[model samples]
Target chain A: MRELEERIRREGRVLGTDVLKVDNFLNHQVDPKLMVALGHEFAMRFADAGVTKVLTVESSGIAPAVFTALDLDVPMVFARKRKSITLSADNYTADVYSFTKQETNHIIVDKRFIQPKDSVLIIDDFLANGQAAQGMMEIITAAGANLVGAGIVIEKTFQKGRQLLNEANVRVESLARIEDFVNGQVVFANED
Target chain B: MRELEERIRREGRVLGTDVLKVDNFLNHQVDPKLMVALGHEFAMRFADAGVTKVLTVESSGIAPAVFTALDLDVPMVFARKRKSITLSADNYTADVYSFTKQETNHIIVDKRFIQPKDSVLIIDDFLANGQAAQGMMEIITAAGANLVGAGIVIEKTFQKGRQLLNEANVRVESLARIEDFVNGQVVFANED
Candidate 1:
């Protein structure tokens, strides 16, 4: 977690009060070494949750989900934003509101992938307003699967995402939680 | 490669004549162990190329791209399907035609991540008509980067993807190359 926070401090850019750009090593361009470390941290945090699978949305969430799946020795299921022709009709879907994109899009997963007895660990790159996490939970609930918890690499604590997930009784673990951003200076939630 | 071929034969569904769905392991639902193995194989194939980065498009391509980056000990840069608030104005954009979706989408990569001197290794889940790979090549060229080759998990030999890529002088290494799918049976290309 310290390594992630340090990396964010060194490479992260603050665009506005609401946006943090970490494309250098987090989302668009991924640092696989750091990703593996983050995955190990997630596995350590949720080691006893009986996680059968790791679930995430397309694009940005795939990296962390893959690393966590490797650490937990479980399979990872990513919900596709657009349903291609190759996708089967037997799928569980939920419309997720993207705060950044300012639109709602359906994210889907095959029904056969997530069984009723499985416990899924949801992971993502950023947790802003918790819309994506909520949508993933909806997909899990639709499949009659259990939501183990949510693992986030970077979280904006000033936003209501954490509150929303907590109110829904979902345990959330974030590597770096941003308390506030004032004049391009990031204030950590728990400054060590 | 044998493991991947076996997975496709067992879990892959053949839809009509040209579609082979291996979402269970390759794309939608990813097996991290198998993905890592495929990544290792890619590393072996492109070991002499001096790959500095792993490039791919979003969604399905991110999984194998991550693993390939891990194997190559480099960073993975994935082109986003759409422009978001997080994406900057300075980017190399290319239009990709999706045969399955029957539409053209613009894939963009931030200019800051990929430099002119970087040697890139492109990875993808499938190479059907080579449209996506061609688009990625355009981005790499625009950035003045060297494309070492393409590492594909599955290639439909019956399609013109390989031939098109070869015509473009792009080296392609596919783990499983399908020669034909006759009467619900998969015929693999002769391995060297």
Candidate 2:
């Protein structure tokens, strides 16, 4: 977490009021060593949760989720995102609205991946509005699987996502929590 | 390589004559240990290439690319795919046509990620039509970066991808090379 926070401080760019671009290491251009550390942290935080599977959305979440699954010695499932919603009998689908993109996209998970016997942990890059996490939680519920918790790489504490997850009764662990972005600089929550 | 071939034989589903659905491990629901092994293999293969960065497309390619980068001690960059092309001055873009989806999506990489002094190695989940690899190569060329080669997790020998890469004079290393799918069974090109 310290390493991540340091990386964010060094390379992260704050655009406008809330947007934090960590393309240099976290997403887009990834630092694999940092990802390993992030994944190890998530796995350590949820070591006793009986996590049978690690679930996340496609693209950004795959890097962190895969490493977390590796650390936990479990299978990682990434929910596929579709621009247009398509109903399928073999898959559990949920609609997620991205506040940043200002568009609604459907997230889908194959029914065969998650089951009633499995306990799932959600991993994501950024927890902004919590739409992506909510969608994964919906899919996990539909599969009759137990939700262990959510692991976020970079969380915007000022946003509604953290509170939303709390209301849903999901345990959340974020490596780097942004308190606010003021004058093109990031203010982290729980600064050490 | 034998381990990967074994996995393909056991869990891979050949949907039709040509399409091999490896959603169980290679893409959608990923097996992290297997991915680690694949990445280690790729890293060993390209260890002498002086790779400064590992490159791949988003979603499926992130897992392997990150691990490969980790083993190689380099950064990994995944090209962002856009449904609608948006020309930008800060990014190098290439149009890739997905044969399976029958749609063209533009893959973009920021100019800051790929530099002229960097030696990039392309890593991907599969090599079928070579569209994704070709697009990455174009981006590498545009950035004036040195391309060591491509490390493919699975390569269908019967497809035009291998021939296309060969024609392009790019060295390719594939962990699992499928000769054909005979009656829903994968035939490896090199059976050791």
Candidate 3:
């Protein structure tokens, strides 16, 4: 966790007040070693939660989810934003509003993937508004699966995404929680 | 490779002419153990290629790309179709046509991710008509990097994807090459 905070301090780019671009190691480009370490950390943190499956949204969330799933020795499932002809007709879906893209897209998980007997953990890169995590939680509820918690790489606490998930009775464990960006520096909640 | 072939033969579903869905493991819901095995196989095949980076498009490609990058001990980069506010403006992009989606979308990679000193290996879930691979190849070319080859999980050989990449002088190594789905059974090129 300290290493992730250090990497964010070193490589994360803060644009305006909310956007933290981790170009050098997370999102877009990735360090696989770092990803593996993150996965191990998540597994270590939530080992007793009885997680049977790892869930995430497509694109940016897939890498960490895969590594986490591997560390947990469980199956990984990702919700899709883009509709594919090859995808089945039966699915559980929820709308996620992205402030970055300035749009709401329907994120879907095939009904066949999630089961009532499974315990699911949601993983992702960043949690800003918590819209994506909330959407994934809805999918988990729809499938009748037990929601363990969310494992996020970075959470912008100022954006109040943590409050959103906590209100929904969802536990969030972010490796790095950014309290604010002051003078082009990332400030962590626990640092000072 | 044998295990992959077995998985495709067992779990892969044939919907129509070319729609082979491995919903149980490959896409949608994924088996991390199988993915790790597939990654190891790909690494074994391209072990001597001097791969500096592993490149793939986002969503479905990210899982295998992560595993492949871990096995190769290199960083991974995924091209994005959805625009994000955090994403940098300077990018190298290419238009990729998705036959399943019946649309062409622009895929982008940040200019700083891929460099001239890099030797990129494109990894993906499938190679149908190879448009995605071609688009990724263009991104590698834009960076002035050497393209080692494409490591594909599955290839519908009848679709002539192999021919296209071969014509472009890019080597392709598919774990399972489908000759065709005969009588609802996946037929491999080497089996016959």
TM-score of each model, in listed order: 0.96, 0.99, 0.96
Best by DockQ: 2
Model 3 lDDT tens row, A5-105: 99989888989877889977888898988988898999988899999999999878877888899999999998888442244569888888888978788
Error of 2 at B91 (Å): 0.2
User: How do all the candidates rank in terms of DockQ, highest first?
Assistant: 2, 1, 3
Off by over 4 Å in 2: none
Report the alpha-carbon TM-score of model 1 versus the true structure.
Answer: 0.96
- What is the per-residue lDDT of model 2 for residues A54-164, given as tens digits with 9 covering 90 to 100? 999998999999999999999999999999866989999999998988999999999999999999999999999999999999999999999999999999998999999
Instruction: Provide the interface RMSD of candidate 1 in angstroms, 1 decimal place.
Output: 0.7
For residues B146-171, write the lDDT of model 3, one tens digit per residue.
Answer: 99999999999999678999999999
Top TM-score: which candidate number?
2
Chain B TM, cand. 1: 0.94
Query: Lowest-lDDT window of 10 residues in candidate 1 chain A?
Result: A80-89
For the predicted complex of model 3, DockQ is 0.83
What 10-residue stretch in candidate 2 chain A is worst by lDDT? A183-192
True contacts kept of 3: 0.91
TM-score of chain B of each: 0.94, 0.98, 0.95
